[model samples]
Target: MTTALLLIDVQKAWDDPSWGVRSTPGAEANVARLLAGFRAAGRPVLHVRHASANPASPLHPDQPGHGFKPEAAPRPGEPVFTKSVHAAFLGTGLEDHLRAHGITGLVIAGITTHLCVSSTARLGANLGFAVTVVSDASSALSLDDGEGGRIPAETAHRVALAELRGQFAAVQTTDEVLAGL
Candidate 1:
């Protein structure tokens, strides 16, 4: 079975502190490791960059944050899919590309674990792809839970991973995935 690495929204905007403290402090390093592993294994690598339409947002097209973080930047020949929405497949043609390339499985990692990463993974599962989410290679930001209390980033990240496990993905760590590959 062919597998591809899907790195989503690992952009410079995540470095901006205005978004608040994020979970998975080692996420970037782990993502870099996953990238290196995928390249070494001669596996396909796809990137999803989030571009906010809102001019005031850090991820707006005119902002530097719209570009990828150095550690997760795509190489010259790698495909980069840009999207304005949360799910990578929404308007990106990512699923089509994967199908065209005969990719039957996906290893996903990225920033905002509870958002883009989770959305993409769930969609992938529903589309019949074998999905594995790298826990250490994804991060999430803490946000108001709507009741005036803040949900810690770590909690959100863990909960998202848990939700994806078994149902949407097989959650694994960087080391575990690399060693298996």
Candidate 2:
């Protein structure tokens, strides 16, 4: 099966302190490892950049933070799909591109595990792609639990992976994914 590496929103915006505490401090390293593996194997490497619609957000196109982080930056021939929302597949020609490339499986990794990473994995699975989410290659920031309670970043990351584990995608660690690659 042909599998491509899909990196979602691994941008400088994620480093903004306004995001509060985040989990998986080493995620960028894992992402870099995955990128290297994909490049070495001659597999496709796709990138999704989130351009926040809100001007105040660090991810706004006008902000320097909108640029991709070095570890996840797209190389010359790699395709980059820019989106304004959480799901990489929405409003981005990502699905069409994958289809055009005859890509049947996707190995997903990147920032905000509870949001973009999870959303993309679910949508990819629903769209009939075999999706594998690299648990250690994604990070998550703490969030308000809606009742004034705070959800720790690690907890949020774990829950998100658990939710996608069986139903949406195969959730594996970076080592497992690298070994498979």
Candidate 3:
């Protein structure tokens, strides 16, 4: 099957202190590794950047953080789909681009595993695409538990991967994905 590497929201904005502590300190390295693998294999590589609508968000277009992180930066030929929401596919024409390129499967890695990564994987699966999420190549920030408690970043990341595994996408480590590539 023809597969593509989709890196979502691996941007400088995620490094901002306001986002809280993030799990998976090695995620950016893993993402870079995956990018190298895909490039070596001559497969497609797509990027999804979050252009937050909120003016105060670091991801806002006017912010310096809107730029991609060095490890996940797109090369001249790679396609970048900018979005204003959690799901990369929403109004991004990502699906159409994939279809046009004959990409049937997607290997996804990104920042904030429980948000953009999860949303994109679910939507991709529902749209009939085979999606594999690279667990070690995605990070998540600590979150409010909605009960006066806080969910640790590690716990949140693990739970998000657990929820997507065997349902929306196949969750694998960076090593596994590299071996496959």
- The clash number for model 1 is 0
**Candidate 1 global lDDT:** 0.95
Across 74-143, the per-residue lDDT of candidate 3 in tens digits comes to 9999999999889999999999999999999999999889999999999999999999999999999999
Best by lDDT: 3
Per-residue lDDT over 1-181 for candidate 2, one digit per residue giving the tens place of the 0 to 100 score = 8899999999999889999988999999999999999999899999999998999999999999999999988999999999998999999999999999899999999988999999999999999999999999999999898998999999999999999999999998889988897
Error of 1 at 88 (Å): 0.5
Candidate 2 residue pairs in clash (backbone atoms < 3 Å): none
lDDT of 3 at 87: 92
Model 1 misplaced regions, further than 4 Å:
none
**Considering summed lDDT, which 10 consecutive residues are worst modelled in model 2?**
172-181
What Cα-based lDDT does every candidate model obtain?
0.95, 0.94, 0.95
